[model samples]
Target: AAAVAGMRDNNAILSSRDWARRDVLMQTKCAPLPREEGRPAPRPLNLVQAATVASHAWPPQSTCETLGLTALCDTVRSVAVNREVIAAVSNKNIFHMLQLYVNGIKAAGIKNSMVVALDDETAAWLKVRDVANYVKVLRSRTGDTGNHATSGLKFKVLIDFLSVGCSV
Candidate 1:
Protein backbone atom coordinates (compact mmCIF):
# COMPACT_ATOMS: atom_id res chain seq x y z
CA ALA A 1 0.00 0.00 0.00
CA ALA A 2 2.79 2.39 0.93
CA ALA A 3 4.75 1.63 -2.23
CA VAL A 4 1.68 2.17 -4.37
CA ALA A 5 0.98 5.48 -2.63
CA GLY A 6 4.57 6.61 -3.25
CA MET A 7 4.34 5.61 -6.88
CA ARG A 8 1.21 7.72 -7.21
CA ASP A 9 2.84 10.68 -5.47
CA ASN A 10 5.88 10.35 -7.72
CA ASN A 11 3.60 10.27 -10.73
CA ALA A 12 1.88 13.38 -9.44
CA ILE A 13 5.22 15.14 -9.14
CA LEU A 14 6.16 14.04 -12.64
CA SER A 15 2.88 15.27 -14.11
CA SER A 16 3.45 18.72 -12.58
CA ARG A 17 6.86 18.90 -14.31
CA ASP A 18 8.51 19.82 -11.00
CA TRP A 19 12.08 19.23 -12.06
CA ALA A 20 13.42 21.63 -9.43
CA ARG A 21 11.82 19.44 -6.74
CA ARG A 22 13.57 16.40 -8.16
CA ASP A 23 16.66 16.86 -5.98
CA VAL A 24 14.50 17.22 -2.85
CA LEU A 25 12.58 14.11 -3.84
CA MET A 26 15.82 12.27 -4.42
CA GLN A 27 17.09 13.31 -1.00
CA THR A 28 13.82 12.02 0.48
CA LYS A 29 14.13 8.79 -1.51
CA CYS A 30 10.80 8.77 -3.36
CA ALA A 31 10.03 6.64 -6.46
CA PRO A 32 12.40 6.30 -9.42
CA LEU A 33 12.23 9.16 -11.89
CA PRO A 34 11.60 8.69 -15.59
CA ARG A 35 14.64 9.02 -17.82
CA GLU A 36 15.18 12.60 -19.12
CA GLU A 37 17.28 13.13 -22.28
CA GLY A 38 19.92 15.30 -20.57
CA ARG A 39 19.48 14.16 -16.94
CA PRO A 40 21.97 12.09 -14.95
CA ALA A 41 21.16 8.53 -13.88
CA PRO A 42 18.39 8.06 -11.30
CA ARG A 43 19.28 6.27 -8.08
CA PRO A 44 17.45 3.44 -6.36
CA LEU A 45 15.29 4.25 -3.30
CA ASN A 46 14.16 2.32 -0.23
CA LEU A 47 10.57 1.71 -1.34
CA VAL A 48 9.65 0.35 2.10
CA GLN A 49 10.46 3.65 3.79
CA ALA A 50 8.91 5.65 0.98
CA ALA A 51 5.72 3.68 1.37
CA THR A 52 5.51 4.36 5.11
CA VAL A 53 5.71 8.11 4.43
CA ALA A 54 3.24 7.89 1.55
CA SER A 55 0.54 6.34 3.75
CA HIS A 56 0.36 9.58 5.75
CA ALA A 57 -0.04 11.77 2.66
CA TRP A 58 -3.04 14.12 2.51
CA PRO A 59 -6.18 13.35 0.51
CA PRO A 60 -5.48 9.65 0.58
CA GLN A 61 -6.87 7.47 -2.16
CA SER A 62 -7.70 3.79 -1.95
CA THR A 63 -5.20 1.42 -3.52
CA CYS A 64 -5.65 -2.14 -4.84
CA GLU A 65 -4.57 -3.70 -1.54
CA THR A 66 -7.05 -1.61 0.45
CA LEU A 67 -9.84 -2.39 -2.01
CA GLY A 68 -8.97 -6.09 -2.01
CA LEU A 69 -9.10 -6.20 1.80
CA THR A 70 -12.42 -4.33 1.80
CA ALA A 71 -13.88 -6.88 -0.62
CA LEU A 72 -12.72 -9.79 1.54
CA CYS A 73 -13.75 -8.09 4.81
CA ASP A 74 -17.39 -7.76 3.77
CA THR A 75 -18.07 -11.24 5.08
CA VAL A 76 -16.39 -10.48 8.37
CA ARG A 77 -18.39 -7.24 8.77
CA SER A 78 -21.55 -9.28 8.39
CA VAL A 79 -20.78 -11.31 11.51
CA ALA A 80 -22.84 -10.83 14.70
CA VAL A 81 -20.08 -9.09 16.67
CA ASN A 82 -18.33 -5.84 15.83
CA ARG A 83 -14.85 -6.40 14.48
CA GLU A 84 -13.38 -3.95 16.99
CA VAL A 85 -15.10 -5.77 19.87
CA ILE A 86 -13.82 -9.09 18.57
CA ALA A 87 -10.37 -7.63 18.17
CA ALA A 88 -10.27 -6.58 21.83
CA VAL A 89 -11.35 -10.02 23.03
CA SER A 90 -9.14 -12.01 20.68
CA ASN A 91 -6.00 -9.95 21.21
CA LYS A 92 -5.98 -10.34 24.96
CA ASN A 93 -7.10 -12.82 27.62
CA ILE A 94 -10.91 -13.01 27.67
CA PHE A 95 -11.15 -11.96 31.32
CA HIS A 96 -8.90 -8.93 30.84
CA MET A 97 -10.28 -8.09 27.44
CA LEU A 98 -13.97 -8.31 28.42
CA GLN A 99 -14.07 -4.75 29.70
CA LEU A 100 -12.42 -3.41 26.56
CA TYR A 101 -14.83 -5.39 24.37
CA VAL A 102 -17.79 -4.12 26.36
CA ASN A 103 -16.48 -0.56 26.14
CA GLY A 104 -15.95 -0.94 22.41
CA ILE A 105 -19.53 -2.14 21.91
CA LYS A 106 -20.85 0.74 23.96
CA ALA A 107 -18.66 3.24 22.16
CA ALA A 108 -19.83 1.92 18.80
CA GLY A 109 -23.49 1.92 19.95
CA ILE A 110 -23.76 -1.81 19.26
CA LYS A 111 -26.57 -3.32 21.26
CA ASN A 112 -26.07 -6.50 23.24
CA SER A 113 -28.82 -8.31 21.31
CA MET A 114 -26.78 -7.82 18.15
CA VAL A 115 -24.18 -10.09 19.73
CA VAL A 116 -26.68 -12.86 20.63
CA ALA A 117 -30.40 -13.44 20.61
CA LEU A 118 -32.41 -12.71 23.77
CA ASP A 119 -35.91 -11.39 24.40
CA ASP A 120 -36.93 -9.17 27.33
CA GLU A 121 -38.07 -12.18 29.42
CA THR A 122 -34.93 -14.06 28.53
CA ALA A 123 -32.78 -11.02 29.19
CA ALA A 124 -34.45 -10.56 32.58
CA TRP A 125 -34.11 -14.26 33.30
CA LEU A 126 -30.51 -14.30 32.21
CA LYS A 127 -29.78 -11.37 34.50
CA VAL A 128 -30.58 -13.52 37.47
CA ARG A 129 -29.19 -16.71 36.04
CA ASP A 130 -25.99 -17.91 37.76
CA VAL A 131 -23.96 -17.44 34.55
CA ALA A 132 -25.38 -13.95 34.19
CA ASN A 133 -24.54 -13.05 37.79
CA TYR A 134 -20.93 -13.82 36.95
CA VAL A 135 -21.15 -11.38 34.08
CA LYS A 136 -22.74 -8.80 36.35
CA VAL A 137 -19.90 -9.24 38.79
CA LEU A 138 -17.42 -8.96 35.97
CA ARG A 139 -19.06 -5.76 34.83
CA SER A 140 -19.13 -4.34 38.36
CA ARG A 141 -15.49 -5.24 38.84
CA THR A 142 -14.63 -3.63 35.56
CA GLY A 143 -16.69 -0.49 36.37
CA ASP A 144 -19.14 -1.05 33.52
CA THR A 145 -22.89 -0.42 33.62
CA GLY A 146 -25.97 -2.58 32.93
CA ASN A 147 -25.75 -1.47 29.31
CA HIS A 148 -22.93 -3.93 28.76
CA ALA A 149 -24.86 -6.84 30.27
CA THR A 150 -28.26 -6.53 28.59
CA SER A 151 -29.22 -7.72 25.08
CA GLY A 152 -29.35 -5.32 22.12
CA LEU A 153 -32.90 -5.39 20.73
CA LYS A 154 -32.76 -2.68 18.05
CA PHE A 155 -30.55 -3.92 15.24
CA LYS A 156 -33.07 -4.76 12.51
CA VAL A 157 -30.38 -6.16 10.26
CA LEU A 158 -29.32 -8.62 12.92
CA ILE A 159 -32.93 -9.59 13.44
CA ASP A 160 -33.27 -10.02 9.68
CA PHE A 161 -30.17 -12.17 9.56
CA LEU A 162 -31.51 -14.31 12.40
CA SER A 163 -34.89 -14.71 10.78
CA VAL A 164 -33.62 -15.22 7.25
CA GLY A 165 -30.37 -17.01 8.08
CA CYS A 166 -28.18 -17.81 5.04
CA SER A 167 -30.81 -16.42 2.71
CA VAL A 168 -29.83 -12.92 3.90
Candidate 2:
Protein backbone atom coordinates (compact mmCIF):
# COMPACT_ATOMS: atom_id res chain seq x y z
CA ALA A 1 0.00 0.00 0.00
CA ALA A 2 2.72 2.48 0.87
CA ALA A 3 4.68 1.66 -2.28
CA VAL A 4 1.65 2.18 -4.51
CA ALA A 5 0.83 5.51 -2.83
CA GLY A 6 4.41 6.68 -3.14
CA MET A 7 4.46 6.05 -6.89
CA ARG A 8 1.14 7.83 -7.36
CA ASP A 9 2.35 10.92 -5.49
CA ASN A 10 5.67 10.85 -7.35
CA ASN A 11 4.00 10.86 -10.79
CA ALA A 12 2.19 14.12 -9.91
CA ILE A 13 5.23 16.02 -8.55
CA LEU A 14 7.60 15.04 -11.34
CA SER A 15 5.73 16.84 -14.17
CA SER A 16 7.14 14.28 -16.64
CA ARG A 17 4.52 11.71 -17.59
CA ASP A 18 6.91 8.80 -17.49
CA TRP A 19 9.87 7.72 -15.43
CA ALA A 20 11.56 4.39 -16.24
CA ARG A 21 13.67 4.22 -13.12
CA ARG A 22 10.71 4.01 -10.76
CA ASP A 23 8.78 1.25 -12.51
CA VAL A 24 7.46 -1.27 -9.95
CA LEU A 25 9.31 -3.84 -11.97
CA MET A 26 12.51 -2.42 -10.51
CA GLN A 27 11.78 -4.23 -7.27
CA THR A 28 11.40 -7.61 -8.98
CA LYS A 29 13.85 -8.76 -11.64
CA CYS A 30 10.88 -8.84 -14.05
CA ALA A 31 11.06 -5.17 -15.07
CA PRO A 32 10.96 -4.54 -18.82
CA LEU A 33 13.74 -2.74 -20.63
CA PRO A 34 13.44 0.98 -21.40
CA ARG A 35 12.70 1.87 -25.02
CA GLU A 36 15.61 3.99 -26.22
CA GLU A 37 17.65 4.35 -29.38
CA GLY A 38 20.96 3.92 -27.58
CA ARG A 39 21.56 0.60 -25.86
CA PRO A 40 22.37 0.81 -22.17
CA ALA A 41 25.27 -1.30 -20.98
CA PRO A 42 24.08 -4.83 -20.13
CA ARG A 43 23.17 -5.35 -16.48
CA PRO A 44 22.18 -8.50 -14.57
CA LEU A 45 18.45 -7.79 -14.98
CA ASN A 46 18.99 -7.09 -18.68
CA LEU A 47 20.20 -10.66 -19.01
CA VAL A 48 17.71 -13.45 -18.43
CA GLN A 49 19.75 -16.17 -16.80
CA ALA A 50 18.24 -19.60 -17.41
CA ALA A 51 17.14 -20.54 -13.88
CA THR A 52 18.75 -23.99 -13.91
CA VAL A 53 18.30 -25.47 -10.43
CA ALA A 54 18.38 -29.16 -11.31
CA SER A 55 21.68 -30.81 -10.43
CA HIS A 56 20.61 -33.80 -12.52
CA ALA A 57 18.31 -32.21 -15.08
CA TRP A 58 20.33 -30.99 -18.01
CA PRO A 59 21.18 -27.28 -17.88
CA PRO A 60 18.99 -24.53 -19.35
CA GLN A 61 17.38 -25.06 -22.73
CA SER A 62 18.40 -28.71 -22.80
CA THR A 63 14.76 -29.20 -23.76
CA CYS A 64 15.56 -27.69 -27.13
CA GLU A 65 17.99 -30.42 -28.09
CA THR A 66 15.30 -31.96 -30.25
CA LEU A 67 14.74 -30.49 -33.71
CA GLY A 68 11.11 -29.60 -32.98
CA LEU A 69 11.42 -27.32 -29.92
CA THR A 70 14.61 -25.82 -31.25
CA ALA A 71 12.91 -24.82 -34.49
CA LEU A 72 9.80 -23.55 -32.77
CA CYS A 73 11.74 -21.51 -30.21
CA ASP A 74 13.34 -19.51 -33.01
CA THR A 75 10.00 -18.23 -34.34
CA VAL A 76 9.18 -16.53 -31.04
CA ARG A 77 9.42 -12.76 -30.51
CA SER A 78 12.13 -13.47 -27.94
CA VAL A 79 13.63 -16.47 -26.20
CA ALA A 80 13.96 -16.96 -22.43
CA VAL A 81 14.82 -20.61 -21.75
CA ASN A 82 16.22 -22.83 -24.47
CA ARG A 83 18.02 -26.06 -23.59
CA GLU A 84 18.48 -27.94 -26.85
CA VAL A 85 22.06 -29.07 -26.92
CA ILE A 86 22.37 -30.38 -23.39
CA ALA A 87 21.98 -34.08 -22.67
CA ALA A 88 19.84 -35.22 -19.76
CA VAL A 89 21.59 -34.60 -16.44
CA SER A 90 22.80 -37.59 -14.45
CA ASN A 91 23.97 -37.48 -10.86
CA LYS A 92 24.09 -39.45 -7.64
CA ASN A 93 21.95 -36.76 -5.99
CA ILE A 94 19.04 -36.87 -8.42
CA PHE A 95 16.40 -35.99 -5.84
CA HIS A 96 18.31 -32.94 -4.64
CA MET A 97 18.60 -31.78 -8.24
CA LEU A 98 14.87 -32.31 -8.72
CA GLN A 99 14.08 -30.25 -5.63
CA LEU A 100 16.32 -27.40 -6.69
CA TYR A 101 14.91 -27.50 -10.23
CA VAL A 102 11.37 -27.40 -8.85
CA ASN A 103 12.13 -24.56 -6.43
CA GLY A 104 14.02 -22.54 -9.00
CA ILE A 105 11.14 -22.91 -11.43
CA LYS A 106 8.80 -21.71 -8.69
CA ALA A 107 11.00 -18.64 -8.28
CA ALA A 108 10.63 -17.94 -12.02
CA GLY A 109 7.00 -19.14 -12.31
CA ILE A 110 7.74 -21.96 -14.79
CA LYS A 111 5.60 -25.08 -15.00
CA ASN A 112 5.04 -28.12 -17.15
CA SER A 113 3.66 -31.65 -16.90
CA MET A 114 6.62 -33.45 -18.31
CA VAL A 115 6.32 -37.05 -17.11
CA VAL A 116 9.76 -38.39 -16.29
CA ALA A 117 10.46 -42.07 -16.91
CA LEU A 118 12.81 -43.91 -14.60
CA ASP A 119 14.79 -45.90 -17.13
CA ASP A 120 14.48 -43.45 -20.02
CA GLU A 121 17.71 -41.82 -21.03
CA THR A 122 16.10 -38.50 -22.02
CA ALA A 123 15.13 -36.06 -19.29
CA ALA A 124 12.02 -33.94 -19.61
CA TRP A 125 12.22 -30.17 -19.26
CA LEU A 126 9.99 -27.63 -17.57
CA LYS A 127 9.59 -23.96 -18.47
CA VAL A 128 9.11 -20.94 -16.20
CA ARG A 129 6.13 -18.70 -16.80
CA ASP A 130 4.22 -15.73 -15.37
CA VAL A 131 1.16 -16.72 -13.36
CA ALA A 132 -0.36 -13.22 -13.27
CA ASN A 133 -0.90 -13.28 -17.02
CA TYR A 134 -2.90 -16.47 -16.77
CA VAL A 135 -4.69 -15.40 -13.61
CA LYS A 136 -6.09 -12.21 -15.16
CA VAL A 137 -7.71 -14.12 -17.99
CA LEU A 138 -9.28 -16.59 -15.60
CA ARG A 139 -12.81 -15.54 -14.67
CA SER A 140 -13.00 -17.73 -11.56
CA ARG A 141 -11.24 -16.80 -8.38
CA THR A 142 -9.82 -19.14 -5.75
CA GLY A 143 -7.00 -18.98 -3.24
CA ASP A 144 -3.82 -19.66 -5.24
CA THR A 145 -1.14 -19.66 -2.57
CA GLY A 146 1.15 -22.70 -3.07
CA ASN A 147 3.16 -24.67 -0.55
CA HIS A 148 6.83 -25.46 -1.28
CA ALA A 149 7.63 -27.89 1.49
CA THR A 150 9.13 -31.15 0.21
CA SER A 151 9.26 -33.07 3.50
CA GLY A 152 6.33 -35.41 2.78
CA LEU A 153 6.47 -35.44 -1.01
CA LYS A 154 10.07 -36.63 -0.84
CA PHE A 155 9.05 -39.66 1.19
CA LYS A 156 6.22 -40.47 -1.21
CA VAL A 157 8.56 -40.44 -4.19
CA LEU A 158 11.04 -42.66 -2.47
CA ILE A 159 8.39 -45.09 -1.32
CA ASP A 160 6.60 -45.31 -4.66
CA PHE A 161 9.65 -45.69 -6.86
CA LEU A 162 12.04 -47.58 -4.62
CA SER A 163 12.30 -50.81 -6.60
CA VAL A 164 11.77 -49.36 -10.09
CA GLY A 165 13.43 -45.92 -9.98
CA CYS A 166 16.69 -44.31 -8.95
CA SER A 167 17.27 -44.86 -5.21
CA VAL A 168 18.45 -41.31 -4.58
Name the lDDT of candidate 2.
Answer: 0.30
> By lDDT, who's the top model here?
1
Evaluate model 2: give its TM-score. Answer: 0.23
- Local distance difference test, each candidate: 0.31, 0.30
User: What tens-digit string does per-residue lDDT give for candidate 1 at 1-168?
Assistant: 133323434344354655655445445443344565676776643231133323223112243134333321333334323122121111111323444545445454443222221333333433343111111112233443344432222243232232221112
Residues 59-158 of candidate 2: C-alpha lDDT, one tens digit per residue? 2245434322332223121222332111122222254565565454445433321222222221222222221110001111232212222222334333
Question: How many pairs in model 1 have backbone atoms within 3 A of each other, for residues 3 or more apart or on separate chains, i.e. clashes?
Answer: 3
Question: Highest TM-score, which number?
Answer: 2
Residue 124 in candidate 1, Cα distance off native in Å = 13
Query: With candidate 1 superimposed using the best TM-score fit, by how many Å does residue 75's alpha carbon deviate from the native?
Result: 20
What TM-score would candidate 1 get against the native? 0.18
